[model samples]
Target chain A: MADNVIIEAPMPGVFYRRPDPEEPVFAEEGDDVDAGDKVALIGVMKSFHDVTVDTDGVVTEFLVDNESEVEAGDALLTVAPS
Target chain B: MFEKVLIANRGEIAIRIIQACRELGVTPVAIYSDTDENAKHVRLADEAYNVGGSVARKSYLDGETIIDTAERADAGAIHPGYGFLAENADFARAVEESECTWVGPPSDIMEQFGEKTQARNLMAETGVPIVPGTTDSIESADAVREFGDEHGFPVAIKAAGGGGGRGMRVVERDDDIDSEFEEARQEAEAYFSNPDVYVERFLDDPKHIEVQVLADEHGNVRHLGERDCSTQRRQQKLIEETPSPALDDEQRAALCETARQGVAEAGYVNAGTVEFLYQDGEYYFIEVNARIQVEHTVSEAVTGIDIVKWQLRIAAGEELDFDQSAVEPRDAAIEFRINAEDPSEGFEPMPGTIESYRPPRGIGIRVDDGVDEGDDIAPFYDSMFGKFVVTGQTREEAIERSKRALDETTIEGVPTTIPFHQQVLGDEQFRRAEHSTTYVEEQLDLE
Candidate 1:
């Protein structure tokens, strides 16, 4: 069985699953991603900050919903290593 | 007046509008996000409805849902208490096209002023002294250079639809103009979804003064004295006071009257603010905040007029019964914005649980806030949680009372801008009222 890693939010803000409101999401569960691949955004204080994954893995689950309020260190997604 | 008014906003301003609605014998209805179900505004309103998710986009900024909620609640009017969708022309038009009344200026007026270039041109034609800048949007870096050459170095490239320093960049040198101009355009595109920009001569040091005006649909307009908002950080106002210490009696009258004339010529209605940049002896028109502002408390304190009530009355087709001579503002008042920010860490946003919350009391103190004790400061919205207003017969007395008011107000858990406000009250330049817009960001040292 492959071990999974959790990606946490660096700061508290509104979690965004896509680049723009009318655009497609960056990635969904069961999608493969590599290190430095943008996965989410934290919208705070009229500024948007990108959240990137650090390791190559497949996103298995999303813990936070899009446009939901999030706190720092909250788990956003679970990625299983190949 | 409306029998039921729906406040399409959250926090302090929403509460303010709710109180105004009650005063007019109207029922106040509130809409809240998932996080604000038990919020103070919700608890105070006559009726509360769930808008959507906690984040503002899914809730507060959703125009379609807001209209639907207003319709379902049987609200006769919708009052957008600043921020969110207050200045959105499209939203205003949708509301106007709906059965409910929009408690603001006409949507056409909002659209005319939304574009900065057109607003400046209108001001010029209306005999308002506009700042020396382009009245048209520039298409390339060459135009910026041309404007800079015609004017001087250190020109400001600003977005046509942006305000509050959102998409503004100042270029100092000849070589840096291109990059700075490009950055301004990109920010303009990203923030406002408009890439058009224009150039203007940046004032090195100037006082930020604004005049409040109230207008009715019947062409009755009146001016409430001036507020000097010189103490700011990164173009964000922290402390605002009425009856500007920088202006004498004659200058105040002229500025106030000019503001009234400018808006009156524009055929504006409802409560709005006319902003200006006052330098040596000249005051230049900047732009208009088409809705009630955060610092409106200072003006209300000095003028003893409920501006919000007038907003409701005007939307109902009421006329101003008093003449210009009958309106007179007395005394001096000050307002300090209390924001959930860590001043020690470059004023970074600190969102957490507020363990304790208390505001001062007595003769001359007023505090407007959205949160109570033990409430959480969510990071999804603006950091400001409240406003502290104090008034006195004289400016000196006002400053003295401000110190006591600041000391009495207490809050724990999340760090606030209280310490910064306290330091400002004690600073010599600030006390003397000699500070300008850039004074706080460039001169004040916070440790």
Candidate 2:
């Protein structure tokens, strides 16, 4: 079986879909990604932490929305193994 | 009584308020910040509303938005559980100005007691012994030194308008007065938005005791004995217990009476706490908490008094049902504040996924928690995950039970104060009741 990947939040924060609202998203559905790739940025009270993909895969669907508040362990994106 | 109450807080307190509402047969409507969508409080409540952003200013502290949500949910009263907007005088006024009732004290009473100096002056008039200090801010280090000489050594310089651990300094000797005074004043300005500082005699090795009092609209007021909260770090209480090990029967009676007299004189109503610092044989009045306290569960555990329900009843214009003598605290109770902090690393807040969490359960152990096993401990809000409250037949039994309870509680994926609590419980000084307010800091060397 292919390694089905799930991107999870590294910390509790507001999940920003893109670096900026007007900018293009870092990862979207069907986007190809490798291990250690940047997936999203999480904004806490005053600091921003980044999330990365753990396994090489093609992004299938975004589990969370842009600027959605999320806790640690919340899924950010789902991916199909390449 | 209110048919529905909106809990304007998050975390353990929200869960606590929700439980209270349920027991009273009132619907509990909980408001959650963006960070708290899956929080335990939200799940436990009758109805949960999304307030706003993860930041407290945009969510929990957004009084207008919260009130709007309350109206939309048709809540009859608002309970601002401790912290967030709990002690905010303006928030209390806003609730009262709205159609709904505020479950704590009246805003006016809050305003009067919010300032430490004002409360000190008010309580002094009622013959409640207060720490010998200047009423106004000491303008300079020279002023602090002069006050210290008159009051004797070890003077405490504190911000006139400060609470928590901010803007406070204990000048052990005359040489340290200038630097400590300046640091305290600067911190006061930075944290509290108030730069004024005052001086007072600092008692060495004092036990922190606070009396829980409740008053109703019908003019009935009573004290619920005293709680010893000497185990603290950075002025934040880590553990609290009822029927202070340090106080004898006479001292307990005297302290309770003094607190009642002080509250009566202040024209206070509703739930409140009169805090005092007891040193040697005398007790000195500290400030008053104008809202339900986090440690109130310990009092309830021993006294069988549901404080939150009474807060609602008192706000609804009902008289307190019990008399002073009618209230007798049985057994001994202890409360451990479980904060998401790395106790090994200077107690820095360690917010992360709970991964696995299991609250201790057994006879006489009650857990008031805000997060589940899979829930994340949000760093955006207060670090307190919950509290472990335990009660037993005697102080020793309570201590033993508390130790077992702490050992049984397992919180993963983040450091917690559990280890510190375990160590404290096992310490010889604590077991022997030889610990003072400075015990934790001195033993840990937090400073």
User: Residue B388: error of model 2 in Å?
Assistant: 1.1
Query: Per-residue lDDT for B1-447 in model 1, tens only?
Result: 899999999889999999999889999999999988888899899899999988788899999999999999999999999999999999999999988999999999999887776887887898989877886899889898888888777788989878777788988765676787788889999999999998888888899999999999999999988999999988789999999999989999999999999999999999999999998888999888899899999989988889999999999999987888877889889999999887888888877888988888887898899988978877778899899999999989999998988898889998899899889889998998889998888888986
How does model 2 score by TM-score? 0.79
For residues A29-69, write the lDDT of model 1, one tens digit per residue: 99999988999999776667898988898999999999888
Q: Say which candidate scores most in TM-score.
A: 1
**Stretches > 4 Å off in candidate 1:** A45-49, B134-199
Write model 2 residue lDDT over B70-170, tens digit each, in one string. 99999999999898898999989999999899999899999989987788888999999999989777789999778877877788788777766466788
Per-candidate Cα lDDT values, in order, are 0.90, 0.86
With candidate 1 superimposed using the best TM-score fit, by how many Å does residue A15's alpha carbon deviate from the native? Answer: 2.3
Please state the error at residue B26 of candidate 1 in Å: 1.1
lDDT of 2 by residue, A5-79 (tens): 777887667787677657898888888999888878987644567788878889888988777677778988898
- Give the residue spans of candidate 2 off by over 4 A: A1-82, B136-150, B156-199, B445-447
Q: Model 1 chain B, poorest ten-residue lDDT window?
A: B172-181
Q: All candidates' TM-scores? A: 0.89, 0.79
Model 2 chain B: ten consecutive residues of lowest lDDT: B438-447
